[model samples]
Target: GGSPALGTRLKYQRARWERKRSRTAKELLETEYKYLEQLDLVLTYFVTILKAKGTLKPAVLETIFGPLESLYSASHVLSLHLEKGNLGAGLENFCQSLDLYGHYAENLEHFFCSLKGISLFCCTQEQVRKNKSFRRFKKLQETRPQFQGRVLEDLLCLPLQRLHQENSLQLLRVQKLLKGQKTQVLTPGRWYIREGWLLVVPSKGEELKRRMFFLFSDILIAAKPCHPLHPLNSNKLSCQAVYPLQQCSVDKVFGHTWSQGGLLSVSLPTLMQVLFLSWHGVSCTHWSYRLLVTSLSSGKEAPLGL
Candidate 1:
């Protein structure tokens, strides 16, 4: 009787594990589909339309888009495989096509420079700005309903950001498969929510530092980029600080002092620390608002100053 009961318990645990695996796979596939759609939007609306209208020359267009066509094709192929319920095949296809992503990453800075009229291509910055056809094309993109308020910079960051998210999800899966083996510092219920680059103002009269922040369910982690001089650790992040949401408060800084971008002051009263963060061409207020909401939901009684 004892052996049979133990066997049944083991079977039940296996079934639960299978269910979790299925759910995770489904989530991965759905996210891939959504990402593919976004890529298509960029290709169809920006690339194809610009080419058809002859708004920019081929070289200029290449400078602006830079491997976007290949990225869209790869994403489409992966999405098709995922749609057929073959997550392994889809991931394998993506892995084989990673060189395309690498190429894009290498050229990302050039793409941004061209977009911002920093004169990376054959045309000068003045030529780009004064080009009537390019201005019309940019205006059209701004009016596209599909973009939902996102600019070209936001769209361009999607691939790398998605890569980070995939890594986080894969790590989570590994943790679950190990049955909480304590492999890493990941807590049981904590999960990744969002992550991005932010300029952190450490203090008055101090230089603004670039930092990569990962927002978890209950904490915000600030990490500094490894120095380029150390090639081995160049791609890694060194965690500088972790702010627990339960003891944090976020407030927007008012006035015209920060004219270039929006500012958010994150106060950690318990730790006696304050962090002022800003993002270029992105809504710092929106992120601060979300942080405040997360803090409130974490059972904190602090009121957010708008």
Candidate 2:
């Protein structure tokens, strides 16, 4: 049997852990309520008004707000579950609805791409300000008690950042792995596009090297797993290179002999360098599409090679 002092210490630690868990659950519930309100603002004030007034075409609106209605519904149900004081049920509800988040994340690049195209073509701030519908909406937003002076941009950005926050646990792990590396920090307005393992093929008959790639709105980062021999760097990733999307062009390699995979050639004409990346299965096509969409959204022209 344990001594009285040991039992007391164990009880104290368990109580502390319980308090921390309780606090975290409460915080999650509170944030969910606020998040639901923001979603409501977008859906009610902006999306509904835009549709009712015929401000944008149906296809354009779909591109700009992919699966937002479904996301709002899922979030509403999750919030209701959380409000019922059952944290376990709330988590279960979220797990059942996880696909909604994945769908939103996958289509996020398209949303920004469509928004950028619109901005470049006809929806500049000056033009929007002069539009009758926008003026009316602006006035309504200003006077609406629920809006609380928040603009459309703020509400629109909420969904984008919500995914980033959802992935905070993975990011925390990444932070620990990159503790000593000089890595570019993720900043607001820079949206994550995609990430995956890829093979780097060399020009000569050299062996293929495996690399991890992270695609963002403006840049692509390639990293390599650190050597296992170094205890401090075990299971860590070391940054290999960062490529600016504006300076790069991607082309699909034709007539590849690989039975189950495809290749992409990322070229930097200014630097006279090309990176041959091989990806397995159908994900190659998906990554190529996302890269093009993200590059265009970042103000770069679509690659002529494509």
Candidate 3:
């Protein structure tokens, strides 16, 4: 037959067919890979949500994670706002402190070791090196977390502090309002408010519990009604009467609010959430609603279209 050269036609035809098949296969693999990747991420997030379901709110996942799998998602807008907050100096200072600590281990380490009663006489260097528990304890004590100049404290104040002194609201009342959602507490509790003070007592504990009661009562009379108080007074003995708790030991509350001014452990997550709420308002768009009002028009987003 005089149709074509057998070798040349067959080679060209095979090459073209191979190219088409390769292209199709590549596209199919890419699509399948993307679908599989998405499925994997979804599965991981579902697992996290299941583990945390008892703790985290399900509805907030949408606003934070973009309609699905909101695990570990924090708000970008809120982050930007916090970056622009008055915490600039505090953060810078905190960084400086960390740098100093990193650069010099002798002084800080020596002090903490002394605090822990390392007893240089009793322990040989080799023994200290082999002691895993000692090493872990030392590591934890050194890194037990401190914050910038009350970065969180200032954040908690950011929302209400903007109000004039005359109209300034009580922090407890506002906090109560914000946290009014219903939930069961396995540890049962009781709180009573009297004359601008809130008293809380745990169910267990009887003898020293009376001490807690007496302590709070004294604090109330001293606070003069519009003061912020820390949960525990570190010093209960002899503190200069700073406020209500002033009469108590200054050390008892020295590291706490009221008498004040000592390094204290702050809850990082709660601090972050509070900062977000303050910067964004009760919900995320509250700031935008406040900003986008026209002078000529009433500047409110129309009431919920319910």
Candidate 4:
């Protein structure tokens, strides 16, 4: 072709911009990788030098920096993905590390924030390319499938939307719980308590193979899980509203005055259910019930109902 059309030129420009952005992000990630390497080396030498001079005990040094060891390993893994241009995987790892910030012995939220800021910058750059619109060309080219796919890939990797520490009440392994309509047979499962919902599934099964039961703060659902042996199109469990929690009654029974082991009974319009939780000490049970009650009460005004 003698010259490309306006749309074609726009597409080329967009692609070029994206490639440039990716390159910049890769450079930033590499810089971070090198910094971390140097930091580790410096830390090792400093510790070694101190120990040799008898200025610092090896145990004291370990006590101080042991937690950082995990952070270093996690960061190294992220850098490896970024260096390989695996942005999708890197982003997922970055998001998951958000949970680890709380676990750091020394506060490292600011460091993680810098990493997030850089990642966001790269994402914004790519987004600008995706949204590069030519107002003159009314019939602009459709969005590239690759860009759409990338968006979807990131979406799936993201944590549960609107889920925060305040909203994520508790996660417990329920030795057994009721499942399905007839309330047939007790089941051992996992219960994930969130601001306004619960995700329940068998504790021992693979994630995809197990069907999820959702109990929103306001409602209860009953449905058959997809058969683990012969799932249809990777069948997903659907929730049906049975009754509103607003009209339901909740009764908690404890083993002792300050009971740790207890049963939380929820009476709905059409059904009654009890969740039993016990730990080595009654304190564990007490906390679980307290958290459950708190989650339920707060869910009434929860910003995200689901």
* Best model per lDDT: 1
List the global CA lDDT of all models. Answer: 0.64, 0.62, 0.26, 0.39
> How high is the lDDT of residue 38 in model 3?
41
* Residue 230 lDDT (model 2): 50
lDDT of 4 by residue, 1-306 (tens): 224564464455445534643664476486656546544542454434445655334544343233444555666776788788765456445444544434441222322224333432231334323433411111121133323323221221122221232123221111122222343112222223321222322235534221223343444434333222233311222333344555656555544333534444555566545342333344334334434553465444432221
Task: Tally clashing residue pairs in candidate 1.
Answer: 0
Q: Which stretches of candidate 1 lie over 4 Å from their true place?
A: 1-16, 113-127, 185-306
| Per-residue lDDT of model 1, residues 235-295, tens digit only | 3456777788888888777662444566678888777556656665344644665577677
Clashing residue pairs in candidate 2 (N, C-alpha, C atoms within 3 angstroms): none
If both were scored by lDDT, which would come out higher, candidate 2 or candidate 3?
2
Please state the error at residue 55 of candidate 4 in Å.
Answer: 9.4
Indicate the TM-score of model 4.
Answer: 0.29
Runs of candidate 3 with Cα error greater than 4 angstroms are: 1-4, 48-306
Better by lDDT, candidate 3 or 1: 1
Model 3 residue 288 CA deviation (Å) reads: 68
Q: After superposition, how far is residue 50 of candidate 2 from its true place, in Å?
A: 15
Report residue 292 deviation for candidate 3 (angstroms).
70
Q: Sort by TM-score, best first.
A: 1, 2, 4, 3
Task: Judge candidate 1 against the unseen true structure and give its global Cα lDDT, from 0 to 1.
Answer: 0.64
| Best of the two (1, 2) by TM-score | 1
Which one wins on TM-score? 1
Residues 1-306, candidate 2, lDDT per residue (tens digit)? 557776665456445434543554566678877887888887887778888988766765665556688878877776676566555455545544545655665555544435433442132344544566656765677568887876555566676566556445323434444536477534444544446778888787888877777776677878776654455664466888878887888767877534455787788767655555656656576667767656665662211112
